[model samples]
Target: MIYLDYVSTTPLNQEVNHMYQSLLNDYFANADSLYSLGLKTSALMEKSRELTAQLLHVLPEEIIFTSGASESNSAAIKGCAFQYQNRGKHIITTAVEHSSVYQSCIQLRDVFGFEVDFISVDASGNLDLKQLEEAIRPDTILITMMYVNNEVGMVFPIEKVYQMIQKINPKIKLHVDMVQALGKMPIDLTHVDLASFSAHKIYGLKGSGVLYKKTSTSLVPLINGGQQEHQLRGGTSNTATHTMFAKTLRLALENLEQKYQYVTSLNHYIREQLTQIPDIVINTPSEHVSPYILNFSCVGYKPEVILHALEMYECYVSTKSTCSSHKSDISRTLQAMGIREDIAKSAIRISFSHHTTQDELDEFLFYLKKTLKTIKKQR
Candidate 1:
């Protein structure tokens, strides 16, 4: 299939797959065992952690391996809320966050009795920093938002937000969900207290991801088991997959500028063609959006109709964040941006990768046009 859903997840990198197989075979011993083989395996995992930290410009001790961003987001939000509730029971987040961050914030407010402020975004999918600043109060303990929005690809002004929050309440922890921004955008977690990422989003195997927690930040454990993940998260990890993730992250960051430029050309091509279509309404902002992801509405047409139509031609795409796409038909992100309900209901996302070829995109556009025309005829 001609896949266009890189933001949801990517096929494993062939090189990373090879590394995983090699590590799996060589490091079969339990990392916690006292035996020599176990010690060797544990040491290798530590090296993997160091390499991953070095690539991300953070300390190895700050990185905690998790199942994926979902777990990381939940752990970061709930842990911070639980740890600092005595100091304050208030938190801040945006309306356009990924499901993991959004739901985690909701759970904090509903079940944990912590007050939450859902910061609003403009019609262009940009957050109002001034409003966000006003929402911060003495009781606010954390501010969690996405580095890049998953559905519309709107990049948040994270550094500015962090600086603002620091000035207001230096103790307020800043947690950023960086899942979609991993390989698609520049990253600097120097001032961020916590950040979350998923391996599957970056051509790495699933069931492995990273949660960077600053050394100074205090967070309660989300799980209690074999004392893994620095006691933040417990249970045995997929040591083989986690160990090979360093190489996977390295490969994703390599030649990022070249990859970005190439993908920008693809996005430009798709955007140009998509705008020419009669009933299309681009939901992704024209400016300040990542080229790796694009969003729009197939006006008056159910997104699934067009999606299935393209699928018949062996083209794959997504209607929204795959994790919660089945949970809701309408795009909550679009609606939060002030889009009309009908338009929001018909919204779909087309995500790209550096490996997506111009020829492949041309074929994709052909199939899209054909699908649209066929639907028009049926109507």
Candidate 2:
């Protein structure tokens, strides 16, 4: 199948798979154990942590490993809110944040007695820095926003937001969910206080991610057990996954410059072709989007219907967040971006990876055009 759903999860590369296999065979002991085998596993885990820290431009002590973005987000939001509640019971975030970030704050509000103020987004899905600044009260301790929106591929102005926050409240913690932006963009962690990352999104193994916190920042532990992952996340580490994650990150970075240009060209070609067709509108902004993902709406067709039609031609696409695929609700992202409900319902997301080829995109175009024609005829 032609997988156009790379944003959800990418298949593991051969090199990553080999690393997984090697770790599984040679280092199977739990890192928490005190034995020699455990020491070997612990050393491997530390090495992986160092590599991840290097990638994110943070100190190794600041990196906390977790299951994925969801857990990392939870740990970042809840951990910070709970720990710093006395400083402020208020938090700031955007209306278009991922459910992981949104739901985590909702839980904090509902269960922990914290107040969350949501900033609005512009039509292009960029957060309103002025509105965000206005939302920050004396009690406001954190600002969480996604670097790259999952559904629309909009690249939020992270540096601008950070600068705005710095001007108003230098003590306010900055948290970014960089799940979709990790390898696609160069993240210099010099400015960002805490950021969430997932290995699976970058063609690495699943169940491996990092939560990077600045040296002065403190976060409570999510999982309670042994003193691992700087004592912020506790459990026996996933040695194999960690090893593959580090190795895969290195592999992903090797061709990142080339991949960026390639994906931009591909997105431009697809956007041009699709825009030429009747009743189609590109949802993502041309200037401020990562080329890896393209979101659009077709006026005459529903997303689910077109998704199924594309599947028949062995072309895979997604309608909404894969995490909440079973929900069957309208996208919170599109809604926050002020898209009409009808248009949002008709939106479909097509994401690509380094493995995707131009020939595959051409084939997808052929099937997509045929499907659109069929849809229009029915209308």
lDDT (CA) per prediction: 0.89, 0.86
In candidate 2 the C-alpha lDDT for residue 321 amounts to 82
Q: Find the candidate with the highest TM-score and give its number.
A: 1
Give the per-residue lDDT digits (tens) of candidate 2, residues 1-379: 8999999999888878876888899999998888999999989888988987787667888888788889999999999998889898999888888899999999999998989988887898777777887787778899999999999988888888888888888888999999998888787788888889898998888888888888898988778887877778777788778766677777778778888998999999999988988878888887788999999998758788899999999999998888877787888888888998777878889999878898999999899989987864324
Q: For residues 194-271, write the lDDT of model 1, one tens digit per residue.
A: 999899999998988889999999899989887787888777767897797788899999998899999999999999
Tell me the deviation in Å of residue 107 in model 2: 0.6
Model 1: residues >4 Å from true position, as ranges? 376-379
Worst 10-residue lDDT window for candidate 2 reads 370-379
Q: TM-scores across all candidates?
A: 0.97, 0.97
What's the TM for model 1?
A: 0.97
